[model samples]
Target: MRIALGVSYLGTAYQGWQSQPGGKTVQDRLERALATFADVPTIATLCAGRTDAGVHGLNQVVHFDAPVERAMNSWVRGTNRYLPDDIAVQWALPVPATFHARNSARSRRYAYVLLESPVRPSVETGRVGWVFRPLALEPMQRAAHHLLGEHDFTSFRAAQCQALSPVKHLHRIDIGRRGPYWRFDFEANAFLHHMIRNIMGCLIAVGQGLRPPDWVAAVRDARNREIAAPTFAPDGLYFLGPVYDADLGLPRHTPAFDWLPL
Candidate 1:
């Protein structure tokens, strides 16, 4: 049977989401726990999106096929028993065979939590991105305006990125402020490699008065990676998860979503 799961994890310790040879990746640990719970040799999972090292997942979606029969509730508690504290299965669903974790998604959302303070993040070290310089929200908002809608994000893509197309539809970029913390919400049909992190770099530059709001459009027009700001750190980048059809009966949110700056 085909099964879908809502997963949440702190990516600080794992080497990104995809399985690696050393077996330290999130996919590695997740697959192991799943196989152990199912008493199988392996049960591979496909995630809606893969996050980089040190990145986090508030609600990540993945789907796998099960070889054995088990109650729906057991899929959550039983599989989690073999998983680490940082990794968990929030909910599970029996999905149609045609359902896909990645392709079935309509859009993906991510948020970059940033802090403005002289002292770096101590308690929330790997959880939040720190900017010592106080940022102006207006300029960043102006810069974000140009990023909305469809555009070729070549300048913001990573050199090692394997995505075939540079053109993507950026549905929204919402910048919200709360005290010393800033939350940048990004919603897109899909993203190129390091797209959000790169855009964050440019937004920060404009927010810090290092660049003008129009500079963001200039970078996009240049279609040159070097013209854009460097890719921002992955520390604050969280996979807010993908949106699927309600009829699919998949859980889109987790408890971690409540703890975020959302």
Candidate 2:
């Protein structure tokens, strides 16, 4: 049977979502747990999105073909038993063979949480990004407007990015703040590697009055990675997961979603 799973994890301890030779990645740990639970040598799984080290996932979706029969709830509870405390399987259900965790996704969402203060973060270290200077929301919001719609995002794309194209359709970018916390939400058909982090670096520059809001347009138009701001730290980035058609009967949110600070 083809089974789909909703997974969540604190990425601070792992080497990212993809499996690596060191076996310290989230994929390695998850596949090991699956093998142990199903009494198989291994069960390869594919995720809806891959996050870098220090990033987090509120509802990362994955799917695999089960090697044996088991209740859906058992898949969740049993597999999690072998996993580390920071990673877990939230929910599971049967899906059509045609359903792909990555390809079938209509769009994806991400959020960056930043703490604006002179003092660096302590308790929230590795979970939130920090800015030493005060940031104005209006300038960042105005700078974000230039990123809306389809455009070549090569300026923000990492040199190692393997995406086939530099163009992506950015659906929306919403910036909001409460107290000293700033949240930037991005929805897009897809994102280039390091795209959001690079953009964040520029927005933060604009927010701190280091660059004017209109400067973002020039960077986008330039399409040269050298001209854009440097990539920001990945600590505050969260993969909010993928959106699928309603007919697929997938769960949109998990308890972890509520745990994030608004």
Per-residue CA lDDT of model 2 for 52-94, tens digit only, reads 8778998999999999999999999999999999999999999
Q: Give the C-alpha lDDT of model 1.
A: 0.94
TM-score of 1: 0.99
Native-to-model Cα distance after best TM-score fit, residue 15 in candidate 2, in Å: 1.2
Each model's backbone clash number:
0, 0
> How high is the CA lDDT of each candidate model?
0.94, 0.94
Off by over 4 Å in 1: none
RMSD of each: 0.7, 0.7
Candidate 2 TM-score over all chains jointly: 0.99
lDDT tens digits, residues 1-262, model 1?
Answer: 9999999999999999999999999999999999999999999999999999999998899999999999989999999999999999989989999999999999999999999999999999999999999899999999999999999999999999888899999999999988899999999999998999999999999999999999999999899999999889999999999999999978778888888875
Once fitted onto the true fold, the runs of candidate 2 whose alpha carbons sit more than 4 angstroms away are none
Record all residue pairs in model 2 with backbone atoms less than 3 Å apart, i.e. clashing. none
